[model samples]
Target chain A: MKQGAVDAVIRGLKAAGVSVVCYLPDSLFKELYPALDADPDIRTIPVTNEGEGAAICGGVFLSGKRAALVMENSGLRASIEPLARMGLGAGIPVIMLMSYRGDLGENNWWAIPHGITMEPLLNAMRIPYRVVRKEDEIETAIHDAYEWAYAAYYHVAIALSGEIVR
Target chain B: MNRFDCMEVLSAQLKDELVILSLGGSVDEWYNAAPHMRKASLFQQQLGCVTPQAFGLAVGLPHRRIVSLDTDGGMLFNLGILATLGNEQPENLFVVVWDNECYQSIGGPPTHTAAQRVDIAAIARGSGVKEAHVATDLATFEEHCRKGLAAREPYIVVAKVTSTVRRDIRRKHSDGREDKYIFVRHVEETENIVIMGPSEHN
Candidate 1:
């Protein structure tokens, strides 16, 4: 991931009033972790898995603060249960910032399914999402996700692609 | 002792601490034990998320104590939360796993804790929870609960209990959405922070 892109995402999270971030690290968004940790305004919790991260974000929401879950697209599959229980079932919103793997121009064969299953899963869960293929859309999409999630009281996903994760 | 007995003793030790109960029997029993504590009690319908949710609340509200009333079946579903809770090491968090060793709510199906004899406290310690204890009786359970609530470090207390159903276990006070609003409002009032706001369109 580009340093500039990471900075932009962080700025957007801060702008969205995200006081805490729970993430499961992936190679695609490796750079974002340290930057998130370094930020004084946001408390970052590196979780064991995406489901745990999702639940933590739900917990943050319950405590009257906004939180984002950062993970790889594959983690979306791992996090469906918590997302459904907390976000869909209970009406608590968890904004997710995921890196797009197995996307266009991808080299890894194992990563292909992640891209294939990401959208369908989000749709099945009725989670509105935006896939950011351009660097400029990164910040706005994240900000929009938070705004929409708060209003809708549901989970939202922002998939980072193109120059941002390249 | 049964789950209700454990909750009955434990509820007396609680103050204004936030509570997250696992799905099924824990929710009903806790509600019966402490109806007035509903504002602080988040009845988690999601199995396996009790501790994780409490961990998030603990991190978000660092100044307040967060208690997770969990069960063996639910804990088995997301055992990794033990490692996460251990790693995060929130000082104000305490987890109480009601180990009846079975999926008591749905049916009397034996879980790993009962059939295979899984020691949850050992797993907690191995997962990095420094203070983990298993209590087989009410006295030990209450003692551990009191210590865990008062301690500055995170603690996991597994109370060995019987799968005895209470006859007067009533329905929860509110549905999920209502519970959320009420709980959030309670947090706002107690913590003096504005969480939910009126609709802008209204």
Candidate 2:
């Protein structure tokens, strides 16, 4: 993943009107996390678990503020409950930006199964998502997502799949 | 009136029009002691999380009222939920954490929460929960709870109740599944949602 792409996401989130950001610790999202933390307009919430983060985002969005969740792909499974029950059920729009850890050209076998299942599971939930392989696409995708989210009060996601971090 | 009776009053007043997530400790004890909760089919979930669960429920069930029955001990575990709640301010949600001066779940051990005299309601205000207040006694609690429910913004009411609670009440659901499972099932069944967590849990 290009540094520019991560920066683009930060800019897009700010531009898209997201005021609260929730995330768990992840080495993969090193660059993006700090930038988000430093933003004065955004209140960054660090949670012990990804599930808690999801739940937090649910609350954040329900309060009528745009919110985002940053985490590794593995964290996805942990957040299943809040995502569905709160994110989708209440029409609270949450933008989930993930750093996909395993995929082609990746050596981490443990992360492979989850990475493989990621898209399919998201599809099963009927969540429309995008794979951000390049930096330029981040902004427009985010803008479109925000539009969809605010207009429909639904959740939107962007999966950073493949070997972008290394 | 007893703490349990206070909760019953809130439940009876709210009826099935709202959803609540009550935490452990005496709040759980009191909620369980109430005969109506056992008999009535309200959208109430008695699980591990009190405030956090309410946060999630409020997100999806936005149009309906959602409340969290929290305890000082449980709230201490993740007070950041308040910061998030304050920042998020879901108008349909209300947070009620009973600060009974002790960890009513364990052996009524004195909680450090009171040491700070945290004034949780003040904390809620500082954090940005639109409506926040602290109440002691049943009447005060009932009034605040009712006002919170009626408010147009997110509300937080911290009620100080007795630490002496029956220890024999069931602390958790009869089901053996951990808190993770309950949330995961909700995520799986819902659409347009993305979840993240539990790389591993003991």
Candidate 3:
């Protein structure tokens, strides 16, 4: 992740009233973690797994605040059950910022499945998301995701790709 | 001892503390014990989320006390949450696990706690939760609850309870969405923060 993209994402989160961020670090979002931790207004919780992050974000929402879960797309697979219980079972919204690991330019053989399953899984869970490839779209996509998630009481995902993740 | 007896003792001592209860017998028992407490949030779905959700609430609202009523089966499903809670170490959080040793809601199938001798409080302690203990009787359970409720450090009290369900005590099925709204409303009002907006009139 580029410094510019990190800054933009932070700005967007702050604008969306995201005071708590529950995340599991992935290679793709490594840069964003330090930036998130350094931000005085935001509290970053490094979770053991994505499912734990999802549940924590749900709790943050219940506490009358906004929270975001940041992780790799594969982490979404790990979080499916909790995500469903939160969004489908209980009308609780958890805004996610995920990295597109196995998209078009990927070379690692292990990552192909990540890209292959990300979109279909998101769709299956009925979570609306935006694949943000351009630098300019990063902030706006995150801002829009939080807005929609809170207003609709459902999840929204922002998948980073293209130059941003590279 | 029975879980409801434990719940009754805990409920009598609670004031302004937020409680999160896992699905199944605990929910019904809690509702029966403290129906008037609006600070309680009952889970109708998400079997393993009771503690993690409470952890999040504890983190978000550091000043308020968070009490989580979890079960042995729920704990077994998400044992990783114990590590997370231990690592985070939220001083205001207290977890009470009703170890009935079976999946009581799903027709009394034996859980790992029953067959394999899983010590949940020991697991919690090993996972980094400093104040963890197990109680077998009503007096010991009540004492632990009282200490946990008043303590500054986070506490995990696993009460060894029986598998018997009080058939006479029942609570209506709480809709998940309505439960979320009510819980959020309670948080907003107590914390003096705006969380939800009115639904648009179409």
Candidate 4:
């Protein structure tokens, strides 16, 4: 992730009233983690897995504060059940900021399944998401996700792909 | 000891302290034990989330006391949270697990702790929690909750309970959405903040 994009994520999350972040590191978004950890206003937590991160983010919402779960798209698969339980069953929203792992970028072979299953899984969960490719749209994508999620009492996803993560 | 006995002791110490109960038999018992207390319990909605969500609540409200009425089965399902909780070690968090040794609801099969296959308190300590203990009797359990609540430390107490059900607990369906709203509103009211429907929210 570019420094500009990293800064945009931090600012956007703060602007969207997300004061805490629970993340499981993935190589694609490695740089963003440190910046998030150093931010003074945001309470950053390093989770053992994406499932733990999703539930932690839900807890943050329950505590009268907004939070975001940052991770690779593969973590989405790990978090699906809790996400479903929270979003679909309880109307608790988890604003997810994930790195698009298996986009059109011809990279690692392990990345293929991530791209293939990402959208279909999102659709299956009825979670609204946008795959962001440009740097300029990163902030708005995050800001809008928090907005839409809180209003509808639903979860939203924003995957940074293309130039933003590459 | 039974779950009701353990919860009654803990409920006696609560005053404006927030609680998040694990899914299953523990929910109705806690509700029955302390009907007016501020609490949230996911009824058959999500499994293995009570502790993690309570951890989030503790982190979110660093100044307030947060309790988790977690279960042995739920704890086994997501043991990784122990590492995270120990690592963070939020001071306002207090965790109490009802270790009944089996899945009391789903035909009563033995869980990891049934024959001592897993020790949750030890795992929590190994994971990084500064204080963790096992209470087999009501007196030990009460002492632990009293001291833990007074100190407001990150403490985990695994209370051993029998598979016996409490006939007095009123069984009913608590929809996840309904619990969420009521719980959130209680937090807002106690904390003096507006939590519901906030875009540029605090």
Candidate with the greatest lDDT versus the true structure:
1
Indicate the residue-level lDDT of B89 in model 2: 70
- Across residues B1-202, which tens digit of lDDT does each residue of candidate 4 receive? 9789888888887888888877767767777888768344434346788789889988889898888888899899899999998788788888898899999878699998998868999998898886899999999999999877766558999999998877776865557778888888778877888778545546
DockQ of each: 0.77, 0.13, 0.76, 0.77
iRMS of candidate 2, one decimal? 10.0
**Candidates ranked by lDDT, best first?**
1, 3, 4, 2
Residues A46-86 of candidate 4: C-alpha lDDT, one tens digit per residue: 99999889999988987889899999999999999889988
Candidate 2 chain B weakest ten by summed lDDT? B39-48
Q: What is the lDDT of residue A63 in candidate 1?
A: 87
RMSD (Cα, Å) of model 3 = 1.5
Across A1-166, the per-residue lDDT of candidate 2 in tens digits comes to 4577677888989898887777886877888788888889877777667767876675555344567888987778877655675544444446788887775767777878778887887887677888777667778878888777665556778877554465
lDDT of 3 by residue, B77-192 (tens): 88989998887778899999989998898899898988756899899999999899999999999899999988888899999999988889777565788888778888788888
- Give the poorly placed runs of model 3, Cα more than 4 Å off: B199-202
The candidate that wins on TM-score is 1
Better of 1 and 2 by DockQ: 1
Clashing pairs in 4: none
For each candidate in turn, give its C-alpha RMSD to the true structure in angstroms: 1.3, 10.0, 1.5, 2.1
> Model 1, B79: alpha-carbon shift in Å?
1.2
Residue B152's lDDT within candidate 4 is: 51
The global C-alpha lDDT for each of the candidates, from Candidate 1 onward, is 0.88, 0.65, 0.88, 0.86
